[model samples]
Target: MTAAAAMVRVEGLCKRFSVPRREAGLRAALRALVRREYRVVEAVRDLEFSLAPGERVGFLGPNGAGKTTTLKMLAGLIVPSAGRVEVAGFTPSDRRPEFLRRVSLVMGQKRQLSWDLPAIDNFEFNRVVYEIDPVHYKRRLEELTALLDVGEVMRRPVRQLSLGERMKCELVAALLHGPQVLFLDEPTIGLDVSMQLGIREFIRRYNAEHGATVILTSHYMEDVAALCPRILVIDGGRLRFDGSIEALRRQIRPLRRVSVRAAALPDDPTAMGRVVLREGGRLVLDVAPERVPEVVGALVALPEAQDLAVHDAPLEEVMRALFGREEAADLGGAIGHAR
Candidate 1:
């Protein structure tokens, strides 16, 4: 998309830091103070991408792959070493008040709510800082509290609230000003599965209601699969893949997974395809998409074959293969599709 059509734009973005280096010994450390040894580490390099307004895009990468650094740059938290970044029509490094009011960043490990004070107090403080009209502030606050179902815990001290509760409140505080852009970094880090699902649903609802553009980073594959239709895969400080989940599967894993449940086992199952798993009266097979119909036909011919299911490979496995953690041959043919 063109820069004017996008809510967030980045071009040839790069970030470098001069990290101090010293030997292991205390004597080496003392000598380094007089003449410090430094090495340049490129956190992000030649990064380029753009997000159309209201697009829920996933930012994915391994640890230290610069996902968080990219988010920080987009949020105007730090200046980039090179390239240009624009969010909401303003340069992020400038940290203009207009830009700040239009975007919000939430890091899972960070807390904006006061520990000793109730969450409500934090909300009020944010309201004053953002100079929200009292009438609109009250109306927005009510809508958020009800949507998050955190009205009961708003009066409780933030420290006393559970992790899930605190996270919900934190989102409320960040969103009090009705930001049109959201940068979320591991927003569901330690929550249980149910809590994660709840948070994901809330984000989907909020985005649909406000048409807010969202960029999210998470290690949890389920979060990405459930919320983001388009994903940006970055590794070694560069963009590796940008496409839909289906396209990723087609690129990395072209085989179709067929699962079957039967009353008895066939003497030779390899004739059909590779047997991935075999349990009591249950079997999983990996077969080429073109051969799926034939395999299913053969399996159905068996009197003992009671049920069968077909599906694509899992997202976690696709990501692992994308990062070169697993051999591409093991994932199957139809590789070389990624750009």
Candidate 2:
């Protein structure tokens, strides 16, 4: 999207942190204390990307490929070391009231609700803090609580609520003001499968119904695969890939997985592709894209072929292939420490 038309615009974005350096020994430590040395660590490296209004995009990266750093820059929590960031036509670091009102941030690992108070009370506090009109606040609260099934949960003390309940309340608080841009950082961390699914569906529904631009970061591959159509892959504090999940899967792992279950298994399965799994009446292979149809036909012709399936490589595998063992380990360490 063009800069003028984009809801979020960034160029040459970078973040550098000055870290104190000291030796291990006591004498060295004392000397360092008197004359402390510093080293510059580049956390985000000349990143460039933009998001259109109402678009849900994901930032994919190892532990600390500057995903949170970039989010903070966009949210105006911290200023970028260099480059320009305009969200809703306002620079983030300015922390202007207008800009803050236009955006909302939800972090899974953190809590914005007061632990001792009921979430309903906290919502009231937020209504005042965000300067939301009483009528609009009541309407939005009812809408969110009903949609998330959190009407009763919001009335209980936040500390007494289950993690799922608390997360639902968090979502309610974040959306009560009708933000145009929603930034989510690990929005579903440490929840059961059912809870995760509920949260996932809620986010999708909220985005669709409100048309809020959603920028998300999640360690769970399923979350990104389900929520984001477009993804930005970052490694070593730099943009690596930007495209749809299907495109990423195709680019990183070209093989198509074909599996079949037959009463009588094939004698020469290797002719089809690389054998991934083999057992009584079951065979799974990684076939080339062009050979998938031919292989599927052959497998289907087998006696009593009961179950047959064809799919691209899983998202986890695609991500593993995208980063090598040694390189990802090294970068994960340095970037994790920096973040």
Candidate 3:
């Protein structure tokens, strides 16, 4: 999409920080007391992308890959050292009142509600802070509470609510002003499977009803796989991949996965394809896309094979191969410490 048509635009984005350096000795520490040594770390490097209105995109990367830093920059929590970012036609770093009203940022680990007070109190507080019309706020709150199924918990103290309830309230508070853009960083973090699904559905419904552009970052692959059609992957503080999830699969991993349950094992499973796993009566194979039909046919013909299934490689495996786990591990340690 053209920049004008996009709700969010980032160009040549870069964020750098100068971190103090010190050795592991008392002498070095004493020397640093007088003068400190510093090194520049690039938290985000040359990021360029645009999100059209109502688009749901996943921002993915390993730990310390600049995912959170980029989200902070886009949400106006931090300024980029270099680059231009425009969200809903306003420069984020400017943090103008109008801009703030049009966008909301929700970090799962952060809480905006008062712990000692009821969640409804926090909701009312937000209405005043955002200057939301009382009538509009009431209608919006009712709608959000109903959709998130958090009405029963709204009157309870924030500290008394469970994590899932708290997260729902957090989302409700963030959306009270009716934002056109949302930055969600690990919104489902620390939630159970059912709770995660509830939040995911709420996000999907909110985006659909409001036509809000959403950018989500999560450690849960299921969240990304279910909600986002497009994905942007970053590594080592650089934009490594940006495209549809299907495109990412095709580019990084072209093989299809075939699983079969049988009463007896085939002495040489390699005849069908590369054996990925073998456990007693079950076998999993990685077969080329073109060879799937042939492999499935072969497996079905086997007297021992009872159930056979064909599928694509899991997103986790695809991502692991794409990022190279070893490289990500090394970068995580170095970049995490620097940041």
Computed on alpha carbons, the lDDT of every model, listed in order, comes to 0.88, 0.89, 0.89
The Cα error of candidate 1 at residue 233, in Å, is 0.3
lDDT of 1 by residue, 120-214 (tens): 99999999999999999999999999999999899999999999999999999999999999999999999999999999999999999999999
TM-score (all chains, Cα) for each model: 0.92, 0.92, 0.94
lDDT of 3 by residue, 105-136 (tens): 88899998999999999999999999999899
Candidate 2, residues 192-290, lDDT tens digits: the string is: 899999999999999999999999999999999999998888877787777788877776678999998999888888999999999988999999999
Alpha-carbon runs more than 4 Å astray in model 3: 325-339
Better of 2 and 3 by TM-score: 3
- Candidate 1 versus the native: TM-score? 0.92
Can you list the residue pairs that collide in candidate 1? Answer: none
Total backbone clashes of model 2? 0
Candidates ranked by TM-score, best first?
Answer: 3, 1, 2
Candidate 1 overall Cα lDDT vs. reference? 0.88
Question: lDDT at 255 for candidate 1?
Answer: 82
What lDDT does candidate 3 reach at residue 116? 96
